[model samples]
Target: MAIVALRAPLKDLAGGRSEVKVDGASVIDVLRALEAEHPRIVGWILDEQGRIRRHVNVFVNGELTREDAPLSADDRVQVLHSITGGTA
Candidate 1:
């Protein structure tokens, strides 16, 4: 199982949990497991095409990674909401 840390609204959506334990072989799998537990988190992290949203960033062991990235029992995954701003 991997330790998934949810940030901001993601955590808010996940019943105010900061971290969750999920079993999966890859990032997507972990996400799926998480979604299974928290249905409201469905479209917040993944899109209709089952892809990570552009506004959402995922990191594995402190490094940015793709959805297909491999995972291990001891791995730590962080899901963050990207902040975007435009000059007035």
Candidate 2:
């Protein structure tokens, strides 16, 4: 199983659960497992069309991950709300 951390911005959407464990052999599989338990949370990470949102960032084992990054049972995943503020 892989541990996935949720960002604070979407805490409400996740029922206040900060972290979750998912079983999968790859990033896609882990995400699918999360979707099964908390379907609503899927939208928090993935877009309506099932694509990762630009404002959301994912890290695997403490490193940033690509869209098709590889994952394993021992990998750690974290979701972060990207810093988007800029000078006005």
TM, every model: 0.92, 0.80
Evaluated at residue 21, the lDDT of candidate 1 is: 97
lDDT of 1 at 33: 96
Model 2 ranges off by over 4 Å: 85-88
Residue 4, candidate 2: C-alpha displacement in angstroms: 0.6
- Candidate 1: clashing residue pairs, number: 0
Q: Give per-residue CA lDDT, model 1, range 1-88, as digits (tens).
A: 8999997788988999999999999999999999999999999899989999987889999999989999999799999876753235
The clash count of every prediction, one per candidate, is 0, 0
For model 1, the run of ten residues with the poorest summed lDDT: 79-88
